[model samples]
Target: MTTITFTVSVLCLLPQSALARWACVRACPAACTCTQEKSCSVLCDRSGLAELPKEFPCEASAISLEKNRLKFLSERAFGTLPSLKSLSLDHNNISFITPGAFKGLSNLLELKMAHNDYISYLHTRAFTGLKKLLRLDLSDCNLFSIPDRIFIEQTALKELLCFQNNFRRIPGAIRGMENLTHIYLERNKIEAVAYNSLLGLGSLRYLNLQENRINVIHDNAFQDLLRLENFYLNDNLLSDLPRLAFRGLARLKMLNLGGNQLTNVSKTWFGDLVELEVLYLDRNQLLNIEEGAFENLTSLITLHLNSNNLSTLPFSVFQPIYFLGHLYLFRNPWECDCSLDWLKQWMESYKLVRDIPCAAPPSLAGLDLSQVVFPAVNGTCVEPAELNLTTASSETTATTENRFNSLISKLLQQELREEMGNGTESLRNDTLLDSEEAQLAAGVGGRWTQSVQSLLCFTLTWLLFGPLHLSDAGFWLYCT
Candidate 1:
């Protein structure tokens, strides 16, 4: 009777708490197992199960019913999982979702449905009560149209990934998901987006319109997203960006315009984005950047202008991005002359490298460019025969600092303050771009000698000694 009293006390204490505890300790799925503490997880990856068993043995918190041969998700299929949170149904043959299929997935936060073959349409309210949902990924699913009313009632949606879909146009009056933050639309056939199609999305932060045939975007097209941060418009056919194209994006950060066939870009293109950082312009045919073209981008970081037909970069080239880091410039026809002397000095003062791969020709292809020196200023170093000897010594002797070394050392400091944010003294192994030193140009540099010899030949031809015979073979021997 005493022992029975103890057992009755435990049972009579509480009923609901005992039932909840029992649900976790039970054994589940034969092909899968759990630890003694009993944390249930389904690892049915790459399994060819046709249909979910009428009764799954163990209760799990996360389910992986992906990579199966299932054709349809029947009503109430996942209704019994009260604690399920994450579900991955990717790469499946699923073609249909009966109403009430996701009946009790209210606690779910992420749902992955990417890379499926036959999910043509979705049942209305299929994911009805998942109020805590944060991400819904349905990319590469061959979708054409989305029922705008499907997500009209969800209040907590944040990120939506729909890249690689065949959407020709967006639906009208898209539901006002006030808390939505990101929307991916890359690789779609979208021709246009209505001015108000993205209305009521005040929290949207990212909008990717890459790889689409989007030629026309009306003014105020993105007037709804006041807090947008990143916008990608690469690989499109845009001729121009309307003056007010980015009117409402005061907090915009990064903008990508590479791979487009644009012939022009103006200071006004970035007028409204005060906080914008990264800007890509690798392949467009930009003819000019007006002196003050980029004066407004104080927060700009890395600027890419590779693979273009740029003849020169203004001295104020770095005036806008005062805090800029990497300047990708390799393929352009860099005329190594007096005009580019500052670039040589700048490279050495900062000890920076030219990560640019010069594609000049077979003779100079793959030539490491950071070591090349621009011509002397006004041909001064070599013509004065008295100065020739010092310049010669400056080229070869120990302790002689070449223009390349000095320039990279000094400029690398300022560029680093801009590259790696403040207070970082330790640098990575990539400190110098391939460890090029200006010393190679200082000692016995054939190019410098050629300049001196030309000046001597013109001036000394009138001298009694006349011009000393110097073969082109000898000139080439000392330079490399």
Candidate 2:
């Protein structure tokens, strides 16, 4: 019999953004010199000016001087402005900033200086004057390392985003910035959070340590972070997380440990995180989760556990979560046996989950997930709809029977031989040979399996049960 073959064609409809905002094109403020229209803000793209315009004649709050051919900024390059909050100087040709270059724009809040040329030197106290700077984004700027003292005086700074810059370790200067709340140091060359590198940041809430080359964390590396809210350490070289790696983050809210080489979560992995809210552990080589690994996280709201090799979720694995909202558990090699029946209850309750992207077998890729993504599917699958006799008969119809008969005749002539007595003897000399022969005849089930088998068996038995004269008589009598 031919195998049940299927050709699946998937057409995933991507949902584009419905709220794509247009570029903000407000009239320029009366603050700086502009090369464009007096009404529109100037774009000094690749302009080879050594210094900025000292006096801007119109009203503009922001300036974008990206990819310019200026080597340095003169002192007092930025004139006094009553309302300038954002600055974009990314992808420029300059490497040095005079300590007094940004002297007058005290209202500046966000500065983006990403993707610039090699900035091998940053003078001391270069960014000491901005009192209202809240967000300093310096990603992808070229620097081998950073001095820690740049942030010593910016007390009002709340967010320090230095991702994708050149640095091999956590800057020790960041440890003393108490007003800092969130630090995104991912995609850097740092190997570890420096010892006491985060000691005094009492208000620091979120620290993203993802996509780095860190292999290990010294014990008590995070001992003094009492107010940290979220910590992400995914996509690193960590073979194992320390037993108490998160010991002092009592108020920690989220932790991501996916995309690593972690083997399993030791029972003491989450030592003191009582307020943890979300945990992502997918795309790791976790063979098993030890008991009590998540015992203390009563506040966890979401957990991701997709793309592992687990055949089942061990019992009491989620017993501690009474209010868990989403659980991602698909794409693993599940047996689809009675062992997975428990998934039905959790699936029935939650509305959102993880790894639904790779939910069903790729064979059923065309099937709509909304139709079969239910808790009852955790049980055994019903018989294939295409395999039922009535459906197959109706779907294939008369040609199916004709094809089966023709195929069987071809196979019989190729496999069965009357030449050698030994060959026929093997076919006929076995005990229960009659039953085996009947089974062989019945093997080619299709649209008309029973009818063709009946004809073949009746003809063989009629010839066997009577003489030629009697068989001819019986055949003629049956035809009549």
Candidate 3:
């Protein structure tokens, strides 16, 4: 019977093309479909196979075993397919990968084991021979933690996408990968980042930590990332920022701090970012902003301050940020009084303000602040300035007179010297001779004309430099 079987196997060989087809059909596993062109491709997707197919073409370059019942990867699982460049085992039940499981594929560049819900651990030497690997997708693998040395041999990896995992802190597994450029850790369980969490990854450029439980970051959290540019911290629970939290990120361009619990915009929060162009501070509890909070952001172009608890802003808060193009201030309790008139003028001149509606003071509740006309003199205060005393009681009177004379000489032109002297006599009585001043100001022009010039000068000064302090209330009252 053995001699007859050998005789029949020899007789079954036909033409060369037919013989090659028969050999390929015999080598293909029952659970996979194999096709051959310049290279071989074996597809074993959704095959209900509990283990990898044992047989494939020797020259196969791409193998897809996705959506299978694979549970484990043993040593030398893929037998020395030296030409294999891409292998995908996505959406499998793979729970473990023993040491030397991927020891033979020397040319593999991409290995996707993502969406394997049962994979929570990896052996230290599971990926020992993949020296040329570039992209590894392990996202959504139910991984709470990864062994640190698992990637110690994958030195050529560039992008590591591990989003939507269960990591409670920034992983220390990426210590030696100097070629890494992008890391996606968003939507994870990471609560904080230590000072040196990212110590040696100097080539990292894009880091996304948004939509996590991150609330605390040490001051030196990103000190080593000298080349980092884009950082996303939105949709978190951060309440306050340390003074030097972002001290080393001078190259950062875009920052998203929206949807947090930050109560104030501190002046030092963005002090180190000189190249920042876009800033998102919307949907926070921000009610206060320190003066010069955005002084160093000279490159800022878009600013979002909507949906906050802000009631008023300093007129010169955005003076240092001269190149801003878009400003969002909607959904705030804006007191559309005299303090906002300058912003209204700015909005008219700049033409980039968006939907900034008022939410306070019954009358201006729903009106768009850009269109609302503000009264010029509403809530305007003229406080009498007192001179600081530095001399003895006997010399105090003479010193006060001398100071008053000097101030008058500086404020009055040559033609108004006589009036300035008369004004000083009236001021000695601690009264502004209002009726006489009104008549003199009327000689120059109408009340409205005089008021417009003085107010324009004050407004220009306030816009150019910060707020101004005058030593005399009569400066404003001179027109009234």
1 or 3, which is superior by lDDT? 3
- Give lDDT tens digits, candidate 2, residues 1-480: 223222111112222221111111323223323432322344555665556655643344567777766677767676775466777788877788888777777777887777766666676667756888888877777767667777765778888777887778887767768788999989988887655767888888899989988887888778777899888899988888777788878899889988888878787878587798898999988778887888888888888888776655655665676458877777665433333334544555665653433222443343423333323334554423322445566656455445445544643542444333435455455433234334444353322444455457545654565322222444434422
Badly placed stretches (over 4 Å) of model 2 are 1-50, 57-62, 79-84, 335-339, 348-480
**What lDDT score goes with residue 256 in model 2?**
90
**Across residues 1-480, which tens digit of lDDT does each residue of candidate 1 receive?**
999999778767766545444544454455433332344565667667787756543356677777788788888786567667778888898888786677677777888888887987876666777778888888998788777677755578888888998888754424478888888889999887668767888888898989998787887788888989998988887767776677768898888888776666666767777787888887876656666657877887777777666655666755666447666665565434333445556666665437544444333355544654443447552222334456766555423334333543534453455345643344333354222232322332324344345434434432544222232344324333
Ten-residue region with minimum lDDT total, candidate 3: 382-391
TM-score of each: 0.68, 0.63, 0.70
- When summed lDDT is taken over every stretch of 10 residues in candidate 2, the lowest stretch is 15-24
Name the lDDT of candidate 1: 0.66
Q: What is the C-alpha RMSD of each candidate to the true structure, in Å?
A: 19.2, 20.5, 15.8
Better of 1 and 2 by lDDT: 1
lDDT for 67 in candidate 1 is 77
Q: Estimate the lDDT of model 2.
A: 0.65
